[model samples]
Target chain A: MATEHAHVEEHTHPGPRQYVIIGAILAVITLIEFGVFYLEMDAALMTWIILVLSSSKFLLVVGYFMHLKFDDVRFSGLFFAPFVIMVSIGVVLMALFFNLTR
Target chain B: MQYLSGIDDHRTSTGLDNRKMLMWAFLGSDVMFFGTLIGTHLIYRNRSLSGPQEEILSIPITTISTFVLLMSSLAMVLALAAIQRGNMGSFRFWTAIVCVFGSIFIGFQMFEFAEFAHLGLTPRTNLFGSTFLVMTGFHGTHVAVGILWLWTILFASYKGKIHQGNSLQVEIAGLYWHFVDIVWIVIFGVVYLIGAYGAEGRALEEVHHAARAAGIG
Candidate 1:
């Protein structure tokens, strides 16, 4: 176990510089998301755009800043498995509520 | 660099450090927790029976707050990198900045909540008010907790407890902080932008009705 842990630690993680670049990209995406609110597009199109932009920001943060991209794949599974399930439940609930309300 | 001193101490059966795995497990569960709250808010959106609607939501203010939170995530990752590299000074510096940015985000939330209350939109006022308050209130609680967690880690580092040899301590905290930031990203998109847009449309309809009844349309 000790040798295995040492082997894992031997791998290099990104330095401060790369972290800054990732942060810059995240900040740009966030600004674009805010800008979407002001665009005079179709409401459905605007919603899709916002979802795409925000989800992009979400993936960047999770993959880079959280170090999941470099870490063991198990870590990603640990976090995202429940995320997928939760999102499914949320969508189903939203559908039910929309139908009932209508 | 003394990297081997405390590095191999706590390997679990899965070859991952126990602390990191625990944090991921906790975050996985938190996904469900926040998912439910945000889903409830979305389901109840625009069910308000009276005034003080979503128009009271200032996107400019929330935009600033959202940016602040995003920058805090940057500070969090930098702090983790500093600790891993055994740079205590830089770690403390970045962690302090993270705490400050977290506090600023919370300050924006407090001001927004108070503004809503002043506009007569309390939890008891309407569906929008209730769900909005509960959802954002819980998120604010998470931010407040993160602030306290960062401070605790800062204090521990000062006491010579957290160093590069045990960078996992800082890594766990960073995971929690980053999770909180991502959750806010979802809330900003779903609750603030989409929910508020719906309320704005309803508020416009109300204005139109008032104008028509007054023969001013």
Candidate 2:
């Protein structure tokens, strides 16, 4: 009985309405991104804003659309571990190249 | 509704289906792959000694394609939901929408590439051209593969192979489709918006003024 309950929980997912709401959120974030892109401001500030907005969209898609939020934590552990490492390496590589190019 | 026997394969030691676990592992590796590509692009940004730079990029058109891809993701998830609910009609409808949206995105990319090449920004144009084209070209190829994959699953549905019992197939495809969408979200930000900022003539004007001040031109 406990195994059956676990199996049921594993497959539980949001319905169409919830998915649509999440989709709408993602769309609005993209529009905001477009608006932010056109604004005149400090380049660094603009870059940070774009990063935050894009990260939000990324998390939403991974969490909701991909069901990573409600699904198994092991899956998240498997994916995010490499994800964090690569992002760090990517940033470090950028820093290295920028310095060399400068 | 009849349940698929293999929906949740618990035979594994981790109590997870091997197929889904493998997909996640593949995606994890793909994150590193794209991270390297994106990092290379950023590293070489603005290093093009000559040839067309970011100034020639068409932001408005690319933004529309971004929006289309985002909507296709929504359609993809909806398709999966429809299948899980045993609604084949809705599933077919949304699945076809995803294919159409995917094709439209690819069409926009083709137009952009043609325009850029016409302006002399091929892979050999400069560092910017090489990195930019390679990174985005790989992404476009992934999107193309995803469209074909989804279409195959959709066709299989009609043959009675994709019922609620076997909706895991659709779920797996949805995962791949969403991964493609997320990759584009990152590309749109890092490559198009941030990379092209002020390159739409502002940066060129700045360069001209600098050259004039320095008495070079």
Candidate 3:
């Protein structure tokens, strides 16, 4: 629902350049994620790396490709709140699984 | 009501949009479901209940599938653009393309799951099985649902429910499709690539830890 500037914008969409940038960033994030497998770190850092990378890609795709940026900001909230809660539950479930396994 | 400002693209009736809003909320809750499921997968991944486990995720195979899904998103969005421009022909063309791409992705997943099951990894087996099957299985279900939605739209389009003026319908469907793709992006990194690359995950983790140790994180 983002309004254009009275018929003077370059493109209706965010322009192809933005998509390219998004793609490049995603590729970099993917590389970083895969890159983590080689290091000798404790469990906490390993988890943190993946979490940050995943969250970044998630935000970018939803905000850009989904046009949540152009659409209502409420849509972003709708998408985000669940995401955070789900991630919290994800953390709890993983921890619970660990405890149960032990 | 004031919140309607952004999404008000001149729909005669928001009946569908309201329904979509509700469905999105439900899907939001399902987010928690997948999160828990993936969490379980990660937890048991290190434990390795003694079998061909995450080792068989096949980064190359999943990478191909991921590419397919990503392209499907592009197609779906293009379909929306077509519809918005009031070109029914192009809309139908692109929506059909979107459906095909989505189906291929789902079929590949089925094949992968079958392969894993054949290799003795399953929810019935152990903890790894539980998390792996549940998380990916839910994702597969979502894909199936998206396909069903696409096919329905296709049928409706042929029957006249989806038209050039109704690009928003396609947009909503595209939104769901993209959400599914986004989820896979994470799953790709966490489950497939990390599970596959083997060394980068630790390396990146160590780098982060070093940063945090240096108070940079």
In order, what are the TM-scores of chain A for the candidates?
A: 0.87, 0.86, 0.70
Question: What docking class should model 3 receive?
Answer: acceptable
Cα displacement (angstroms), candidate 1, residue A88, comes to: 0.5
Which window of ten consecutive residues has the lowest lDDT sum in model 3 chain B? B7-16
Candidate 3 lDDT by residue in tens digits, B76-150? 776776666667787788788878988999899889889888988877776766778788888989998998998
Q: Ten-residue segment with the worst summed lDDT in candidate 2 chain B? A: B1-10
Query: What is the per-residue lDDT of model 2 for residues B1-217, given as tens digits with 9 covering 90 to 100?
Result: 1243554443368877777788889899988898988889888887777888888888789889998998999999999888867799999999999999999999999999999999999999899899999999999999999999988988988898877766777878888889989999999998888888878676677689879999997
* Total clashing pairs in model 3: 14
Q: Indicate the residue-level lDDT of B10 in model 2.
A: 33
lDDT of 1 by residue, B1-217 (tens): 3555455555667767888898999999999999999988888777766858778999989999999999999999899888866789999999999999999999999999999889998999988888888888998999999999889999998899887767777888889999999999999887777766656677988889989999999
TM-score (C-alpha, index-matched) for candidate 2: 0.93
DockQ of each: 0.69, 0.65, 0.35
lDDT on C-alpha atoms for all candidate structures: 0.86, 0.86, 0.72
